[model samples]
Target: MERSHVPVLPAEIVEFLKPDTTNAGPVVDCTLGEGGHSALLLEHAPDSRLIGVDADATMIERARYFLGPRASQVEFVCAWYDDFWLSYTGARPHRVLFDLGISTFHLAGSGRGFTFREDEPLDMRLSDSVMSAAELLSGISQEDLADIIYVFGEERYSRRIAAAIVRARSSGSLRTTGDLVETVASAVPAAYRRGRISPATRTFQALRIAVNAELERLRMALPRALAALSPDRGRMAVITFHSLEDRLVKWAFRAAAGDEAAVGRSAVTAKHSTASKFAPKLIDTVAMPEGERITVLTRRPVVPSHEEVAGNPASRSAKLRVVEKTRIEESW
Candidate 1:
């Protein structure tokens, strides 16, 4: 089936980021992709302007074209999300979105190795400035490779796959998407190879994550995003495509919402400190320091509906989490 230019959970996003009709301000779309979400935001919130950011220059142009006449309402920035957010000097945004998934155009047209279905160069970089996946694989140690695959991809056979990759690269054979796919297929059991998904899916995902330093970028961007919100009622939404990204969003949001458990080990130290004899004075001195800045709108991540998935299977794994800034004074 031909896919529509539908951003996952479009309705949910528009609703979650519903601007005050009287004074809707700018929205920052940190992962502009094809600009589907930004276009929709412009359509839904007439008063809202969009600051669209993307790492890929090609994708930024594509988004500009996709947005067309509505492009007037957007300011496109070809840069990584963290760089754009950290350096932004404009007015605070009332809405922000980070859809952390590769666009359809990226998979189907990028000629980059985002998909194992096609034979492309092993250059799964989001931008030309970053190292290519092939270069990364060739230089990475098997231990580091396995750690990346297991941690980012959550694939159990990471060790075997990493070993196979090292073997293939040592023989100067692992240079393209096809080579990596073949390596992974041979590394896993035949029964596993016959599964519904491609055997190399996890490996590709891991390489892309590592090449882009995607997780680290997200960790740095989230707090900046929270701080960029218009005080009192700004809303931010992040749509993650996999478990690892989702976990980062979940924990970050929980921490912003001031959940003690979300602080994990740090919470214990604070707890013990508060129990000491001088605790009252300490707490009183910094009474407002630890107040929550955000209220998580969705207790559980909002996933694509079955009907939406039926229409666009690429969105099947998309999970959207949203939060609203509580006040201007509650900066992270």
Candidate 2:
């Protein structure tokens, strides 16, 4: 059975967007996923024509089916959000949305090894991703693999896990999801294996993120989304599930809003370059001074209510942040 997805902070997202007023203009859902968020957003935005973009073709088809009649209002594009937004030539959108979480569809239905409970192939690439987890594991050194798990996953037993992976791969026994999971389980302590979270969770996450270059695309997408916002007080809402993503959104919003503290701090790291193997490009690019033409709507990131989190465990780590465009430079 295909597990249904629930949009996190659905009510809050609609309220922040004020879709009724903005519905006369174009709206964009940069990460359409299974179209759960877009469906809700469009419910309140009757007149809004939508540009829904997603990297996975399967997701585009699933969203198309799930949307049903609402599909008429949306222009579904099977492309990465960054690519779609950067080259977008249509009318600027008044309301934009980005949900940074991976889709429940991928975890529950896609047989590409997104879930550890399955014994599928370790091919964790979305449509636009360059490499597969299997390919990455087969060639990566133990040291590099450890750094990826540590930096991207924040896994404390990353070194041990990487060592185990290296050993299994060398013996040609690390090709399947089960093999990787077993390797990770053997590396972590008994206590860690019995913790609230699965021991292999971080390893899988890190591998998926690295394979997809998720952070790199997000860094490029934010500025483009800001620029594509209509000059007439366009608003954008982004929902992030991890600290790495939230930090990027926060930094972009702060820099775009001209927050004094952000400006001062950004000066030193504005030109920071990635070192190719920097754990899936750990640092996000700071929005430059000229991009300072927006107002941060959410003073702080919004978390899911206890009730919501209880009902939908996936919402537990979600955080929402919104911003409105003050103006757009002609250069944009």
Candidate 3:
């Protein structure tokens, strides 16, 4: 909780999305990590109703404290964003934001082994009900694990990393974040170990994605989010951290904006591979949502300025994409 999460593009988000100024809004923050983004959004449109959702209870509590008196305007929901949206039957949202991917809270504070630098339990479940990373590594096949690391993490050394994990499992050494890091370190080449990015980074990311079902949930949640928007003026902004997430968001937005079908790579398939060796049919075949379309507000993704990134290096890879809902017949 001591490590505060800086919302990636604070000014850009507020400037792009037009939240209801009539005090009759219910702007939903789908991934309310540390409440930084929601706090600023509420401050910008003080009268708007706020519904903050986060899978981690720790994050929820911290966000609640951070929001302080603004808590009165918020309806805090401790649930996955997709799960929350699936059953939600409240007033349509005036504006919605999805700050996708893990935040600093996960790496530094969540004791969930989201960080390879940490020596915590390999329990990377964003929600409580799912299997932890430790459990996943224990039971999964090396080939399937390699595929996940390749397709999800885009790691070139996926086969090596997965094989190392399998070997570590036999010795019961894949129990914690540090153990996994050591295993990854031992598997990859020495040069790769000393690369700019840590060797374990992609493996950890892939494991978290698998354990939390992040991409699957994102696909399910996008159309629902678009549907939840107020048709007249509802806008949704998504900030993705990596290539995989950005690709998914781009395809979904294109579909909503009336691309014939935003068909793209199956979540499990690698571009070089014919098909996924493991996992179900995870192809994205998105289309217009319920006879409605959207106007993609961002022609190109907005990136953090050099000044911002210099101040906060973690913000360097962030990309913000925004969309506004419109009737099918309406032309921008």
Report the number of the highest-lDDT candidate.
Answer: 3
C-alpha displacement of 248 in model 2, angstroms?
1.0
TM-score of 1: 0.88
- Of 2 and 3, the candidate ahead on TM-score is 3
> Candidate 3 on 132-185: residue-level lDDT in tens?
987888789989999999877889999998898899899877778899899999
What stretches of model 2 exceed 4 Å from their correct place?
A: 1-3, 20-24, 263-276, 279-292, 328-332
Best candidate, TM-score-wise? 3
- Per-model TM values vs. the true structure: 0.88, 0.90, 0.93
Better of 1 and 2 by lDDT: 2
> Model 2, 1-332: lDDT tens per residue?
34367888988988887564643668889888889888988898676788889999998888999898999999999898888877888887889999985888788888989889899999888884577888888788888898788766878888899999998888888889999999999999999999998899999998988888887788778878887787577899999888777877887778667665653232112332234265333333445335336888899999999999999999999999999876556673
lDDT of 3: 0.83
The list of candidate 3 runs beyond 4 A from truth reads 1-3, 264-274, 277-291, 328-332
Sorted by TM-score, highest first, which candidate order results?
3, 2, 1
* Residue 129 Cα positional deviation in candidate 1, in Å, after optimal superposition: 1.5
Task: Indicate whether candidate 1 or candidate 2 has the larger TM-score.
Answer: 2
Flag clash pairs in model 2.
Answer: none
For candidate 1, give the lDDT.
Answer: 0.79
Q: After superposition, how far is residue 21 of candidate 1 from its true place, in Å?
A: 3.5
CA shift of 118, model 3, Å:
1.8
TM-score of model 2 (CA atoms): 0.90
